[model samples]
Structures are given as C-alpha cells and as structure tokens.
Target: MDASLLREREAFLRRAKALPVVEKPRAVSNAVNDLGPPPTKRIASSVPSDLRSAELRPALQGKFAVLSSVVKYMKQRHLERDTHPLTVEEILEEARLHDTPQSTIRWLEEEVGLIVVTKE
Candidate 1:
C-alpha cells in the first residue's frame, strides 16, 4: 500500500463522526406478562352423543365446511407421504392449529371416521 494513501485513510479515521447515544428500550421482565394471562380455554367436559351438524348455527356450519376442507387437505397430504392412517388429532394439530374447536374432534371421529379423538 502507498504511504500517502495510508496517511489519508488514518486522517479520515481520526475525523470520523459518531452517532448520538440513544437510550435503550426498557427490557420487559417477562414478555408474556405484557400480554396478560392467557385466556382460559373453554374445555368441553364432554360432547353430546347426539349433536347433529344441522343443529349447529348456519355460520358455525359454514366453519365446519371449512374444517372439513382442512381435514381433507390433511388426509390428502398424508396419503401422498405414505399409506399410513391420518387421524382427527393430526388434522386439528396441523400447521400449529391451536384454536380448533373441541367438538370438531367428535365430528372428525363420527363424521370423518379418522378416529384418535379419544382412545378407548
């Protein structure tokens, strides 16, 4: 490297400016605490044996149709992988699905016939 180039680089480094100090953001002790307590899940004690799809509200029935599509999608994806059986639990739990309805499990077991909603 040339001595003049090195001297110019050194001079530039000496004259370099710095950004003004900014206060750091307050650290949360627990990030989850900021969100408040997790909402309590409405744990279904038991799904009625005689619950009918038609008995459900129109909007809810539409959601069931969507849920049915999800089950079919899950089943199709599973079938593509291998001949292994896909269950209601897998469909519910798929794609990090947490908000799936409890009654859907029974619907899956009885309506879709994949089972694994509960073990006998």
Candidate 2:
C-alpha cells in the first residue's frame, strides 16, 4: 500500500473513533402506565347444567327423539370399532330420509344437549 493512502486511512480512523456514538432512545414503560390496567378475560360456560330439565314443545320432543334414534343408529353402524366424528351434513342427510325438519336439527343441537356442533 502507498504511504499517503496509509496516512489518510489512519487519519480517517482516528477521526471516526473520536466521533461520539449516538444510541437509539429506549422505550419507557411509563407510556403504557397511562393506558391503565389490561382488560380482564371473560370465562364462558359452553354447556349449561339445567339443559335437561328444560321443557320442550310436543313436536320438538318427537323430533328430538327421532334425531337421537338416527344418531344412535349411525354411531353403531359407522363408528362401531373406531371412533369417528359425525358431521352436521351427514346427520342432516340421514335426518332428511326420516323427514326431519332442518330447524329441528338446529334446535336439537343448540337448545337440547343431544348433539354438539363443533367447528372444523
């Protein structure tokens, strides 16, 4: 390397080293302190205990029984050896054969605890 280049490099390095370092401002916790406490999580009860004791209309009661029978038969036939998750579509199809109303199926699942509908 040339002596002139070496001298210039050393001078530049010395000047760079002498320069003061600037640090980024750190986030202060006091910014969040003014926001107040975090929101409390709400606990939701999925299944109500008093579902069985609830009275149903005569027509609904009959429909529920029909749906229950159909589900029981399907469980025995399709899921005898291994456990199989039943879908709403399959149940609805079977219920259609028995002339069960779509509303009745929804009622059985939502109101009555006879069937559980879970998200896939």
Candidate 3:
C-alpha cells in the first residue's frame, strides 16, 4: 500500500478509536441547608438505692439463683475443663438460662453446698 493511503487509513482508525468526552455535574449542597437539626440525647434514670426495692431484690435474687443453679449443674455436668468456682458472671448466665426461679436458686445452693462438703 502507498504511504499516503496508509496515513489516511491510520487517521481514520485513530478517529474511530477516540471516544467522546462528557462532563458530569458535580454534587453540591449548602452547609446551612445540610445542617437541619441537632441530634437529641436521652438520659437514663438513676438506679434505686434500696437493694430490696421491688425492682431490685427480685432481679438480684433471681439472678443469684439462676447462677447458683448453673454453677451446680456445671460442677455436676463437667461443662468445662476448669473446676474452679463459678464467677458471678457465669452464675448470672446460668441463672439467665434457668430463668432464675427462687426455688431453683435455693435448691441449687443447698445441693452445691452438700456436694462440696461431701467431696471434701
């Protein structure tokens, strides 16, 4: 092919390969308009001072009982490798599981104490 024809073909190919450029609108917002309202903060009620308050004692006793039941079960069932005493948190979790009934708690405490004494 001749150089002039080749040059024309290259120019046509270049024009075909080039893409059209377009400008997209930039996102813009006024600071005053964007700042519409301030966030609201809520304060929680203070905990009661009385340990035996209607809301307090039952929750605590229930938790304690639940934990005691769980701890006793763990000792008997060997749920974990550690044989150390159950922490308040573990007892609470167990209590949570057992629904922490007062009777269950008292029974578990008695049972656990007896088992401990027997083992010793």
Clash pairs, model 2 backbone:
none
lDDT of 3 by residue, 1-120 (tens): 999999999999999889676899866767666877877898765866563364543345554545455557677647567565564345546545534455654555575442432222
lDDT per residue as tens, model 2, 1-120: 999999999999999999999999977779778779998999875657566333342234676576666667667666557455556656656544345567776776777655555658
Query: Between prediction 2 and prediction 3, which has the larger TM-score?
Result: 2
Off by over 4 Å in 1: 1-63, 117-120
Task: Order the numbered candidates by lDDT, best leading.
Answer: 2, 1, 3
Instruction: Rank candidates, TM-score, best first.
Output: 2, 1, 3
After aligning candidate 1 to the native by TM-score, how far in Å is the CA of 49 from where it should be?
Answer: 38
The TM-score values for the models, in the order shown, are 0.33, 0.34, 0.24
List residue ranges in candidate 2 displaced over 4 A: 1-61, 94-98, 116-119
Better of 1 and 2 by TM-score: 2
lDDT of each model, Cα atoms only?
Answer: 0.62, 0.65, 0.57
Worst 10 residues of 3 by lDDT: 111-120
lDDT for residue 79 in candidate 2, whole number 0-100 = 57
lDDT of 1 by residue, 6-68 (tens): 999988877774445579999978889798899999977465745653355333555466465
The per-candidate count of clashes, in order, stands at 0, 0, 2
TM-score leader? 2
